[model samples]
Target: MSSVYILEPPTSGKVLLKTTVGDIDVELWAKETPKTCRNFIQLCLEGYYDNTIFHRVVKGFIAQGGDPNGDGTGGESIYGEPFKDEFHQRLRFTRRGLLAMANGGKDDNGSQFFFTLGATPELQDKHTIFGKITGDTIFNMLKLEDGLIRDERPIYPHKIIKTEVLNNPFADIQPRLRQVEVKEKKKKEKKPGVKNFKLLSFGEEAEEDEEESTRVNEKFVGKGKSTHDVLDDPKLSSKTEDVDEENDDVEEVNPEEQLESIRKKLKREHKKPVPTSTTTAEPIDTYESFLEEERREKKKKQFEEIQKEIQNVKKEYHKNKLKKKEEDIIATEKKVQEDKTIQEYKDEFDKYKNKKDALPKKGAGREQFTLNLLEKFKKKIQSMKDGEENEEDNEEEQAWLKHRLCFQDKNPVLAKDANRKDDDWFEIYDPRNALNKRRRGETVEKFKK
Candidate 1:
C-alpha cells in the first residue's frame, strides 16, 4: 500500500484579502518566491492594494487586480519601480486559486497581481506564482470568476476593501510610506488705501484726516514733540517757507530729462572700482583626489566590459537568427519541390485525358491508356506514403505532410460529389485516416481499406 502525500500551506506569511464579493485567504510561498512574496506583503501592509478594483477578469483564466488606476495601466511595486520576476522551479500555475504577478513584459513585475481560475499551463513560466488560496477560499475565486462579463470585466465594481496581514515572516520590515509635503498658502498684502479705511469714518472723515497729517508731522519732527510745538519752531518754519518759495520759482523739469540724469548718475557709480577681498585658499586633499581617480578608472573598465558583453550577445543573436532563416529556406524549398512534383503529375493526367477524348470510344488503346494512368497514380501515392514513413521520426515533417494532405482532401477535385456517388478512389488513399492509423502503430497497406 502507498501512503498519500499532502502538501501543507506555509505559516511563514499569510494575508486575507477582503473584497466586495468575498474574502480570500492566501498562503504566501515565501521560501520559493521570496521577492515576489515580500513585494506583495509590503504593498498590502501599505494599503496600496486597498480599494483597488479588479480591472481585468477573464473567465476560466485569471482575475487581475491591484492596479490603483482602476485601469490596467497603473501601480508600481513596493520598490517604487518595476522589479524582476522571481520564477521558482517548484512554483507554477498548475491549479486554480494560484496567486501570481501580472506584468506587461519580461522583468516588468509591478504591484498588479492575479488569481488563476483554473489550471493554466500556458502561463506556467510567464508569471511569478507567489501564493495560493487556502481552505475554502476557492469558493470566493469561483464567485469572482462567475461575475465576469463578456468584456472580461466584472459587471459590477468588484474591489478589494482592505488587506489584513495574518502572519508576516519579515515582521521587522516596514513599508516605506510616501511622504507628501503640503504647500502653505501665502497671505495677500493689503493696499495702502484699503488698510486706512477703518481709521476714517463717513462723518468724522475730515477730523481723522487732520489727525493723521498732525501725526505724520510729529513723527518726523520728534517722537515726544506735538504738531503744535513743531510748527511753533521759528527755524523749522523759516526753512520750510524758503524751500516752498524755491520750488515755486523753479520751472517744472521734463520727465525724460530727469530719467536721463538718473541713468547717467547710475552709470558713473557703476564705473567706480569694486572693492576686492583676499582670502587664503584651502589646500587640496591628495587622498580624496587619488580615490576619485581610481573610482573613475574602475567605472571605465566596467563600462568597457559591459560593452564587450553587449557585442557578444548581439553576435550570438544574429547567428541564431541566421540559422533559423536558413532552416526556413530549406523547409520552403522542400515544400516547393513537393508542389512541383504534384503539378507535373497533374499536367500528365490532363494530357492523358485529352488524348483519351481524341481516341476511339471502344478500343484497346483507350483501355490501355486508362490502365497506365491509374497505375501511375498508384505508384505516386505509394512513393509519397513511403516518404512519410521514412520521415516518421520528424514530428514537424509529419505535421506538414498531414496539413498538406488534409488541404488536398478538401479540394473540389478530390472531395466526394453527391451527384456522382460511384467515385471511391479518394476513400482508398484517404491520408487523414491513414496518418491517424500510422500514429497508432497500425500497418498501412497500399490501396487497402
Candidate 2:
C-alpha cells in the first residue's frame, strides 16, 4: 500500500494585482500542476482572485484569468477535483511575463490562467503548461506591440494593492520593450530632369549677324557715367580712399565751382500765353485713310453674312442626319425583338437551373396534405356560409373545421361563432366560393337564356 502526493501550491502568497490597467504578478505552478497549482493558489488566497476579469481577450493571444462570473465559463474555486496532465517538455512558452494554465476540455484544469501576450508556439501542445509571471511590476511595462498594454485590458484590471512571498526572490529578469519606436526617417527624392536634344552643326554653328553687334551698340554708354553720375563718379568710389583721406584733411570743393552751383538750382516759373485745345488720338492721315476704306467694306459684308450662315448650318446638318438615320434603323429592329424575347427567357432559366437536382421537394406530408386540402375547401365554403348567413345549422360546425387542419400555416381552424354571428360573414357582399356562386349562376342563367 503506497501512494503519497502532498501537492501544495494553493497560493503560498504573492499575488500583487493593483491595476487601473497594469500590475499583476502570479507565481503558482507549485511544482507543475499540483492540482492546477493548488487551484490557482486557492483562488488567490480566498479573496477569490479579487475583481477577477481578463475575460477572453485575444489580441496577440492569451490574457485570460481566474473567472468570477465575468463570463468565460465563470468560476470562483470549485476544485471538486480533476488535474494531472502537466505536459512541460522543457517549459518555455517563450517570453513576455509568462503564466499559463486554463482548460476545460481535457481533465478540465482548474482556476483558469493566462498572461503571455507574446511568444506562443501555436500554444505548444495545446495548453496546460502552467505558471510563469516570475516578476511583475507590470513586468517592466510589458510592451510587445500589436498587443498594446497600458490600459487596453487583457490581464489589465489588476490593482491588488500589495502581495509578498520569497524563497524564489525576483531574479527572473528577461523582459524588455522599453519604448523603442524611433520612426521618421524618410527623405530622398529628386530625380526629374532629362531634356537633352543638342545637335548643332550648320558648319559647326556660330552665325549671330547684326553686323557683329554694331560695335557693341556704339560702345553703349548711358549711365556709364551720366545722370549726375553718383556725385561725379570717380569710378563709382567705394569711398575712394576714404575720400582721399577726407580730402587730405579738408577743403577742395570747386570743380568749376561744381557747375556754377548746379546751374543756379535749375530755376522755374509759369508762362501761359494763349492756345489750349487738347484732345488727341491722332491717326487722321486723310481722315484715318478714309476710315480704312470704310473698314474694308464693312468687313466684306460680314464675310458674306458668315458665308450664308455656313450654308444654313450645312443644310440643317443634312436634315438632322437623315432624321437620325431613320431613328437608328427603327431602334435596331426593336433591339432585335427585345434580344429575341430576352434569349427566350434566358433559355427557360437555364432549363430551370439544370433541372435543379430534379425538383419535387414538397413533402413532409406535404404540409399535412395542404392542410387537409385547405380544411376540406374551407368546410365546403363555411357550411355554405352558415346556410346563407345565419340561417344557422352549419352542418355540424362545418365538420369541426375539417379536423382543425394547419400543417405549417396551411391554416384552417377558425370556425367563427361568437353567438350565432353572421354579419354577412364579414362581407363585401359575401358568396366567396362555390366557384363564386357558380360563376354568378352561369352568368345569370346565360342572361335568362
Candidate 3:
C-alpha cells in the first residue's frame, strides 16, 4: 500500500490560508507525506476549511485548526473514514511554521491540521508533516489581539476566512525515501596500563619550542600587515601623517630668551611680599571644667552600678523561670499518678461487682438448708477475697467487701413472690422494654441502675 502511493513531488507547492489575523502561505511537502498533502489539497479545493477556526492556539507552540466543527471535534476526508499517517524522516516537526495533521491517535488523520510556532522536537515521528508555513503571516498572527486564551484554546476565534492552493510546483520532484536512524557503536573502555612516554631528540625539542614561541607571538601581535594593507587604512595612516607634520612645524628657542626668562622669574620672586606668622593662645582651664570632669566620672560610675543591677535582675528572672518549670513538672507528675490510681480503682470495682452478681441466689426449700448453703457461700467468697488480697493490696476492695455479704439488690424478689413477680425479675431501663411491664400493671422507673 505504501509503494502504490509514493510521493511524486513538484518543484514547489504552497497553500494560502486567509485567516482573521493574517494570510499564511504554507509550502506543502508533497514528496514526503503524499497522502497528507493530497488530503489537505482536496479539502481546500472543496472549500471545506473556509470558515473553520484555529480553536487551539498555544503561544510559542502550535496553532491548530481545520476542523469543520471549528472546535476541533469534527473533520472528514474525501475518502470516507480516516487515513493512515505518512511519515518521512525529512518531514520532521523540528522548526517553526510546520504544517501537520491533527488526529485523535496514530494514523487517524482527516481534515484537521496544525502549524508550529517554534521547534517542537518532542513531536518528532508523532504527527505527519506535509507542509511548512511561509512568509510573515505567522508573526502577524502572533501580534494579533489575544482576547482570551485559556487551556490553549483561542476564545477570540481566529477563523480560517478562506483557503486555496496558491501553487503546486513539485509535480516532477520525487520524495527521497525515508531513512531509519542507525545506532552508533559504543566506544571501548580503556584498560589500566603504565603511561607511555616518548623521548624527543635535542634538536627536535629546540625546533618545537621555537615553533611554540612563534605561535604565541602570532597570537599576541596578530598577522603581519603588508605596506599596502597599512596604506589602505585611512584612520591609522592619517594619524601618523598628522604627527609628522606637527613635529616638522616646531620652532627653535634662543639661549638669550631663556636667560631673560630666568632673570624675570628671580625679579618677580623678590618683588613678592613675605607673609607674617600670627600667634594663637592655648585654651585656659576654668573651675567649670573641673566640675564637668567630676560629674562625668560620677555618671560613668553610676552607669556601672546600673549595669550590675540589670545583671542581678536577669539572674533573678532566670531563677524564677527555672522554679516555675520545676513546679509545673511536679504538678504534671502528681496529676498522672492520680489518674492511674483512679483507673485502677474503677477496674477493680467492676471486677468485684461482676463476681458478686454471678453468685447463685438463695435457694428456697427449708430455712435450715438455706442457712447452711449461705454459710458455705460466705466462706467461699471470703477465701477468694483473701487470695486476691494476698496477691495485691487494695484499700477500696477491703472497704467494699466489708458489706458485700450484707448488700442486696433494691428490687430483689422473695422466694414466695418469685413465681407471681416473674415479669419484674429483669430490670428494663429503656421505655421500649417497658411495654410488657405496663401490660402486667407493674410500675416502671424512669431509670433502672
Instruction: Provide TM-scores for the models.
Output: 0.39, 0.19, 0.35
Misplaced by over 4 Å in model 2 are 1-8, 12-22, 33-126, 129-242, 247-449
Q: Give a tens-digit lDDT track for model 1, residues 80-190.
A: 688888887666666788889999889899999999998799987788888888899789877876653768877775899999999888866688876879999999998
**CA lDDT, every model vs. true structure:** 0.80, 0.59, 0.74
Candidates arranged by TM-score, highest first: 1, 3, 2
Model 3: per-residue Cα lDDT over 1-449, one tens digit each: 34312432432578888888778878887766777777777778667888888888888888888887877889887667899988875455556767788889987888898878777888887788787665777675564336688888866878888987787543543323336599999999999984322344476676776677677667658666555443445545423333544447557789899999999999999999998668677566798789999999999999999999999999999999999999999999999999999999999889889977866666563566668878866765786666532435356546756654443448967565654656557754774666767877777665553
- Alpha-carbon error at 224 in model 1, in Å? 45
lDDT string for model 2 (1-449, tens) is 01111232333324555543556566555555555555555444445556665656565666676676765676633445656557655555665556777777665666667777777887776676656554545453353223435544544343333323333322332222236589999999999985332344542223343334454456555525333333445655433243443445567787898887676655321243457668777666998789999999999999999999999999999999999999999999999999999998998788778766454468886677678768866765676555544344356455545553323546578877756757655534557655778778745456577
- RMSD (Cα, Å) of model 2: 33.6
Candidate 1 displacement at residue 430 in angstroms: 78
Tell me each candidate's RMSD, in Å, in order: 30.9, 33.6, 28.6
Model 3 regions more than 4 Å off: 1-11, 169-449
Write down the worst ten-residue block by lDDT for model 3. Answer: 2-11
